[model samples]
Target chain A: MSFIQTLKQSVGLSTDGLTKRKTVTFGDTTAVGNGRFWSIISVITLSMAWYLGSALELVNPIFWPAPSAVWDQFINISQDGYRNFTLWEHVWASLYRILVGFALGCLIGIPLGFAMGLSEIIRGWFDPIVEFFRPIPPLAFIPLVIIWSGIGERSKILLLFFAALWIMVIAARAGVGSVKLSKIHAAYSLGATKRQILMHVILPNSLPEIFTGMRVAMGICWGTVVAAELVAAESGIGFMIMAASKFLATDIVILGVIVVGVIGYAIDILMRKLEDKLIPWKGKA
Target chain B: MSDLVVNDVSMVFDTPSGEQVHALENVSFSLKQGELLSILGPSGCGKSTLLNIIAGFLAPTDGTVELASTEIHGPGSDRGMVFQQGALFEWLSVAENIGFGLTMKGTPKDEIKKTVDHLLETVGLHDFGEKAIYELSGGMQQRVALARCLANDPDVILMDEPLGALDALTREKMQGLVLKLWKETGKTIILITHSVEEALFLGERLFVMAPRPGRIKKEYSLPFAEAGVTKDPRDVKADPDFGAKREEILNMIWEMEEEIMGQAEE
Candidate 1:
């Protein structure tokens, strides 16, 4: 057996069992009867373990807040507000920044990527600058962005924008580049003009890759927005967390972190649903 | 005048190692209206290169291809080509794929639908019109490809090893379909194949090509394709004359392979 098969067998995973595990972990909606049940059970188990650990006082409450304490902090923030902004205001502010940054990245990156994929000259022009910025961590640019654009909302949004732009461009370029040559030949033989081939053949074929790029960009945008808020922000979930940390309100900090995680997960799920609806022929093609 | 004429076509490729590779040299042929011609050769014999040149996907280093006395410049609706595999757009439905050519010409939506439906029936894919390209089997996909090419009503249909990727049984079935379509439409067809049997079965006129500065080594006018239209392909193949011709062609190709092997060893 190969290493992967041997490892799976050693872990008591038969081929059928591995398939079932995949269905459960990846949320295969068609297999939801069993998968949904298992997913709920797993989540409940984790929450129980966390609650029990806190109740048993295994860690100091100052650093590791109990579930009830976090819940209380959540209720308190919702009712009394935090740092002059209500709970909804903090979430809305963060969402607004992410939307602006991600939308800008997509609008610019998709067209630029297509231009580069279609022409060697355009690729040469943009490739160097894109390559230079792609690998640099979004947080690393915070100092430069603040210096250049100031510590206003512009700097924070710009950080998030830069994070998403390169990923979208690379994905779109790869999508266009990988279209089969035979497909193009077939279209040409059928009397399709250059414009028609671009609109019909290239565009639909590249959509799945572009959608994947959008999802990745959204994730990156969320991370950069939070990190930007942590550095300097007047409102947002990141600001709430940073402010709570300063006052040693560990419960509030934990609540803020949980909220961020939950919101990010929700967004990811929504994107996946949209992908299924819009690009139903993705893997089938 | 012939329906299509290819005169003194030659193709040369400049290798990265500063060598000039002669892909095709002094190749010429003509096809009458409604005639079916097959080019048979081994790999590297430039049969495919010649087909590409005729399809207007490549410009020959010298010479020209003329249709009805008009010089061919590039790919156009006058000539349709069916590729071996991976030609169909996987995202489109079978009907949409067949109607693609019509859509490009701005055919009315209802006319496209009517024509696509007619093609779907012709290809025996009546129930598969709404199905995605990826859902069809290999033979079915090739059938769709043929129907797609036919939808444009081109004067000439170029098939480059269209059945090369199919299994033996499916290949046989597809051969019957090709012959049926050829008889029904009466369009000029130029098929390229490495299969000696396929070449004999499909071509009314055959060009046997050789490699190493690829050129036509011999030509044959065969009755198998005409007989196949009326009689069973198997019975046609089983004829004494067919058997003799098959043996002769097979021996010629075997000798060519041996010569290639000897050159490689030297």
Candidate 2:
């Protein structure tokens, strides 16, 4: 039988004489917890709150940037551009840097993390170096990155790679370490090779932690992209914010922050969805 | 029944402090291939050590164990070991755990599925092959562990108090299942236990060991297992030689323990 047939049979959908077919009836309360209506209602309520607060002058309209101010600023920036850069150009530049840095971090960090997790010798050598650099903020490295790589796109990406590497490596290492020795022993007792054990035992066990780290990295990278642009950039949202501030275009600054928030929130939500789809056996662990 | 001979096996564990503690001292015994034998002793006895040595997880300091013409050195597919705790892989489903040995041997996926299905039925977990290890009861998990071991169809099954962790009720139920499985498979089984009554009910011949510098002190040949099995073995306990053997073993263990303590103090 195929996988689906096997699954169906195990759940007692097989044509067995002793199978019990019980029907479950849902109550009205189930719909409330379904989340669809709740989400729409929350969004509407938040929008109304933003409008009312601006109308009432409860928050200073300049610093807070009322919805109308932010909307007008968005259209103006899209149409006329800022510092020889269109809004889309800035968004694309920042997004590209984030993706490249994240991919690079994962490439280098994950294997090193696994090595550190599995071998005490690796942990002993690398842990001190990790700790020494980890406390210094990624923004602090901005000066050296600019000097070494020049104030080009490369420096901005290197900043992000620096920001993300330690977090991913540590989370990955922790994830691998948390896997029980019994699981490894089980594979060994069954005569699985070392590579086989790492692929099946270590990788699967480390997945939940890896997903968690990715979510955090995405959030952190959103902030880092802006910081990366602050030092020197001909394009990007961070460059837009710094340039707008010189002209006292406060509305543009708030708009840039909100865009960052929205992007961060959307990416985090996607990360959660990926977690749900990948580790479908949550009820077991 | 292939005879298992332990030719002068002694297991002396050397500590980092340069002191040697004997876990098994020149222990020798032969087991009928399919006979269910239990080794009973006090807490510090070498009962489990003997099983571990036979499983090839540890080597005996001064002897060898042979299954017919084959000498056992390392854990192999021919000897299956069931630990006290059912060490089921958390991520693998019941069928996957059972099929693990086949997967390691590079057996085709389809053959693995068939063998896993057959073992699941044999272990009386016919419908649970897809369920997670955590979803099963303590008893059910042990059953899956057994099926996993049996998937390789080993000649001898070594159990180091496999039912020791269960509650009394589950333990009794598991005991019944073990006897049924033994009867069906006719596989040689070496059971290590601390419970005298459990030993009486499981072992055809009870081997008694002492704790200090642990060694096999006595071997009692008996037809107790079949008689003591069905919960009406009160009279079997009162058999002329049964009480005498138990008392003699108990006295020997006590003497050995004191001597060991004296040596340790010095």
RMSD of each: 5.6, 8.6
Model 1: docking quality category? medium
DockQ of 1: 0.76
Q: How accurate is candidate 2 locally (lDDT)?
A: 0.79
Task: Give per-residue CA lDDT, model 2, range A227-275, as digits (tens).
Answer: 7786688788888888887877788988888877787788889888998
Off by over 4 Å in 1: A1-45
lDDT over C-alpha atoms for residue A182 of model 1: 81
lDDT of each: 0.90, 0.79
Q: Which candidate tops TM-score?
A: 1
Runs with alpha carbons beyond 4 Å of true place in candidate 2: A1-53, A58-60, A74-92, A234-237, A280-285, B1-3, B14-20, B40-48, B193-197, B207-209, B217-224, B227-266
Q: For this target, which candidate reaches the highest DockQ against the unseen true structure?
A: 1
